[model samples]
Target: MPRFAANLSMLYPQHDFLDRFAAAAADGFEAVEYLFPYDYSTQELRARLSDNGLVQALFNAPPGDWAAGERGIASLPGREAEFRDGIHQALEYAAVLGNDRIHVMAGLLPDEALRGKHQAVYQENLAFAAAEAAKAGITVLIEPINTRDMPGFFLNRQDQAHAIREAVGASNLKVQFDFYHCQIVEGDVSTTLRRDFANVGHIQIASVPERHEPNLGELNYANLFNLIDSLGYSGWVGCEYRPKGDTHEGLAWLRQWKAQQA
Candidate 1:
């Protein structure tokens, strides 16, 4: 069975951020992930993880000015320095939290005409991040987000993400395959997973269209989970979805999956 990591950023919205760690643990999640850990001291965050016996499965590198609506600066031409600084900061936090993987968000591209410029900057920035992370024994992940949810997200397709990873040629650089996004951008999720399985570094899931519990969506997560096991994927599968009702109440799918596995 694939290990599931509760995405605290989306799950358990009822509790304070710090409190969510324990809530996830009590609900049977062995690991947790969130959007940004920069706001809290590493000691505070680490303590929460240790106290709850939850592993820090993943977290994103700082995206520039999230409050100002800048998702990420990695692919932006003039923000290379800021992007690099963010990568360093993320690495520092990862070390303290004992996380081995970090996701790099590719910022929005408002103008399609400037895609060439953005792609060049993105490739260079990723290469730099991968090299730095490699020295720390960490894997750098790039995810292809759906344009509908993130209208101007630079990376939106599985093939595009893998191509950029190949072009960058960093052995430690890999793709963060999110099934929710993949289903939105391209319908053939299973085939894409199999085709890109080797290059994948991480996995995430949510219901399609509504972005709720995996079992509520158009996709058959049970079969997909089985397929993932068959493919020999031994990585954390992030439950990156918003709950339709009470978070704990919405965890029936998880309990069912675990029971089926047993």
Candidate 2:
């Protein structure tokens, strides 16, 4: 069965940061994920999760500093120090949470001036991160966020993520493919996912155009989910979307879909 994990950060923006996890559990999500978990202490996060029997699915490592327009510069020329530090923080958090998948923000790959050097740095960093993550029995995920949705973000293609995985050559590194961004940057969701499913460790969804809950936009999410099920993908399908209304209202679509599936 394709189990759904709610991205608590997106689903319950109105709630306090720590409370979002419990809210998702109450909303019937067996697993919960988010963009950043750095604000809360690891002990507090784990306690909140245990109290609700919630599984921690996926989350990104720190992105240097979001305030300075620095998303992630893992492949940058002079930011390797900052990138490594961010990765350490993520490893600490993931280890404490008992979660295995840590989404690595690829940041913007350097421009053509030193593109070759940038690629080299990315591969080297991946090798080190993969080994460290493997030691913790954690899988590191490299996601390709759409540049249009998030300008200056590097690693914007599924193929790019695949290349990074190959370079790392580790069993613990995989792609965190997002449907909403992919649909905006590239259509044919089914074919794209099917072609790169082997590299994919996590999946996410949202309606196109508005980036809201599924079933209200261009992507035929039910069919997409069905395709994922049919393909025997046994991974978390994250509800990573901006709710058109409150979190509860957005959840009706998911609940109704579950009843139909039942």
Candidate 3:
């Protein structure tokens, strides 16, 4: 069965970031992932994970100047040095956190005219990051964020992500298959999973349109989970969603799923 990892960034917002580790454990999550871990010291983060008996499953590399609207620097030409530096920083944390994958965000593209140029830059940067991460036994991930959620995002389709991974030509370069975004971008989630399972290194989920709990979505997660298990996708499925109500209260679906699995 696919193991579930609470997305601490979205799921445990009621508590402070550090305290959310315990909250996730209390909620019966065996693993957790967040957007970034730069805010806390590696020792502190590691200690929290160890204490909570949770594994750090995934996280993103620094998206430059997030508040200023720089989602990522990897595909931005002339920001090569900054992107490389971000990779080094991410690896430093991964070493201590013991996580194996890092999602390299592709920032928004203001000019569609520069698509080819930006794509080349993205591929090159991914290759470089993959080389560095491979040294630390880490995999570099690229995700296809839906345009509706993130208009003009650089990477926005599964085929695009797969092509980039091929162009990068690195064993460690993989796709972070997010069901929420995939459903928004392309309708057939199950087929896509089977078709690209080889390229997929990790998976994430949230309901379509509202981005809530999996059970509340139009997509049948229970069946999808069965498909995932049958397909032998032995990777973490990140619960990356906004709670429709109280976080714990919104987990009735999870409780039921766990009961079924048990």
Each prediction's TM-score versus the true structure: 0.99, 0.95, 0.98
> Cα deviation in Å at residue 33, candidate 2?
0.7
Worst 10 residues of 2 by lDDT: 106-115
Ranking by lDDT: 1, 3, 2
Tens digits of lDDT, candidate 1, 175-243? 999999999999899999999999999999999899999999699999999999999999999999999
Best by TM-score: 1
RMSD of 1: 0.6
The model with the greatest lDDT is 1
Clash count, candidate 3 = 0
Q: What TM-score does structure 1 among the candidates reach? A: 0.99
Off by over 4 Å in 1: none
The sequence of per-residue lDDT tens digits that candidate 3 reaches over residues 136-254 is: 98999999999888888998889889998998899999998899999999989999989999989999999988999999869999899999999898889999999998888899999
Clashes by residue pair, model 3: none
**What lDDT does model 3 reach?**
0.92
lDDT of each: 0.95, 0.84, 0.92
lDDT of 2 by residue, 111-201 (tens): 6566678778877777777887888888888888887888767777888779878877998889887898888887777899999998899
Clashing pairs in 2: 72-107, 107-154
Global CA lDDT of candidate 2, please?
Answer: 0.84
Segments in model 2 whose C-alpha atoms lie over 4 Å from true places: none
